[model samples]
Target: MSDVQVRGARLEDEAAIREIADQEMAAQEALDPRFGFRPDASGRYSVYLRERIRDLDSVVFVAEVGGAVVGVAIGTIRKQESLFELRRFGYISDLMVKPAARRLGVGRALYDRLLTWFRGLGVRVARMHVAARSDEARAFWKSVGAEPWLTESWVDVPAADGPPDPAGSEAKPAPKRAAGGYAGDLPDDDPSPAGMADASDDDTDTDDDTDTDAGDEATAGEPTSTRGADE
Candidate 1:
């Protein structure tokens, strides 16, 4: 077994951190059509990842192979409803490792460290999302006791019928649903509104959470792209 280390990510690790997120997004996009995450041309994803690194309520774990980050597990210590009040749930935003690094415990080690971090924060539950059809990822989560807490679905509202004006076509989104899974569970009531999770994660838990598959097998390794559930 190789000597791998796991610890909190530093801001200086932004470039390497973003690279892992980007690569993981690429893998997810290839499998999950609903969660198709696409990176901008900037090759810089810290606009989305920076806050996690600095969050007192969040944890970002990095696994280094030969001193370079090869896997990541970024999550928040959230107070998800129905679970508990002041719940310290580790909502794993992303987890990825290079194909060459697969099955080397890089991921398992990272998970162990972050899990310890969450437990230290007094977290009652932990959450993560997986593609609906990724065998490798499903097995990985299963092996680590990460259950499928929710089932996710999505829709495609065709753009308005009109001339496809270059740099002019806009995709009008649907209104909010009060009982939806992801989109339904947002804490808009909080003074700190997160602007209703980015359009990318149409699967937000804005209201209530229903994770029927919480501990079920996660086959999120399909060959397609997917956006976030909501916020």
Candidate 2:
């Protein structure tokens, strides 16, 4: 077993971090073609990491064995407000373990340190989005005691035939169905919506947007680049 040590990431770790991120992205693309992730040709992922390392609300940690970084985990604490209450939770935005170092506890070490950090900040729950097709990730999270609480689905709406006029009349709202109507279940004949060519469902939650100084944006499913680390 490798003697893995986890610590906060530094500026010097950018190169290795980018390499791992690129590999993760490649694996994601293979798993789902619709995963829309593209790093610039000039290695823009490093720039992205640089910003992340500087964010106060975000935490980035790297796992090292024998003085070489083998894995990374990034997370952020975000405040959420609803009509009932306001609370904060931790979101694991990105995690990657080099192919050779995986299954050697590097990824787990990274995650453990991240969870510790989250707890230190009074975060009670940590959330992450795994790719829908990544069985490895699903099993890993389940083993770690994470449960699936929601499913995210997407549908693309085609553009209108003509541009909207500035003085156009307001659109009417769809009719509201009465409560407890129609057996409260979908019909078995046609489960899909009319005129919709494709619909996709992703159960895992991942952040696809770039990390900002304020905090990381929360996304619904894991992007292709970060899927490999879930193993």
Candidate 3:
């Protein structure tokens, strides 16, 4: 890792970042069809990376070895709900390192740099999501002191014929879990109300209802593409 260089992502790094993201999305899509990326996802994500690179509230870090980009980590500051004690936190949007770079410090290097940026902004906590089925991802995050919580559930849109009967597609609950579903509070009659999903039975993590200890490290989100297997 002594040779690994972690720095802020540059506009020129967009192609490299998108390449990694493409691979990540493709892998996740194979794990579950719901994780599919749009055919034009690469172009759209490039636009997003450009915006994030220039946005004061966001940070994108890239890791390089011998002048080659090997990894990337992206994050943004988010306002917590008015009901929460903490007002703002850093949300890790994506973490990816090429498969060949696994087990190196690249992922952690990118993560730590992004984390420093968050702390500089006075962000008190950091959060992200890992697919429930990605044992390697979960293990990598846990190795870095992230605790797992909340199962994010997804259901196909019920036919719009009636009041939206979701019972047919409801996901089974993970054992012993109490909280976590979609993040927002939708009305009871809301057609798109989210339901709890068990990680044991789920592949993607989308949204969750969570309570964090100040400055804790963690994981939760939609399926992450290529997390470094630093464990």
TM-score of each: 0.66, 0.69, 0.74
- Model 1 / residue 81 / CA error / Å: 4.7
Which regions of candidate 3 fall more than 4 Å away from where they truly are? 157-223, 226-228
lDDT of 2 by residue, 95-190 (tens): 666767766776666666767788788876666555556665554444445555444445664466656746888667867654322221112321
Which candidate number would show the highest lDDT if scored against the true structure?
3
Given candidate 2, what's the lDDT at residue 71? 73
TM-score of 3: 0.74
Candidate 1: misplaced stretches above 4 Å?
A: 39-44, 81-88, 156-231
State how far residue 100 of model 2 sits from its true place (Å).
Answer: 1.1
CA error at residue 138 for candidate 1, angstroms: 0.6
Model 3 over residues 1-231: C-alpha lDDT tens digits? 437788888999988978877777776666557655667766766777788799888778888888999777777776755667766767666677777776666666666676678778777677665655566666556555555554456766556575655477755676652232233222232111011111111122222322212225533222255333562
Tell me model 3's lDDT, rounded to 2 decimals: 0.57
lDDT of 1 at 184: 19
Counting clashing residue pairs in each candidate, in order, gives 49, 4, 4
Model 3 worst lDDT window (10 residues): 192-201
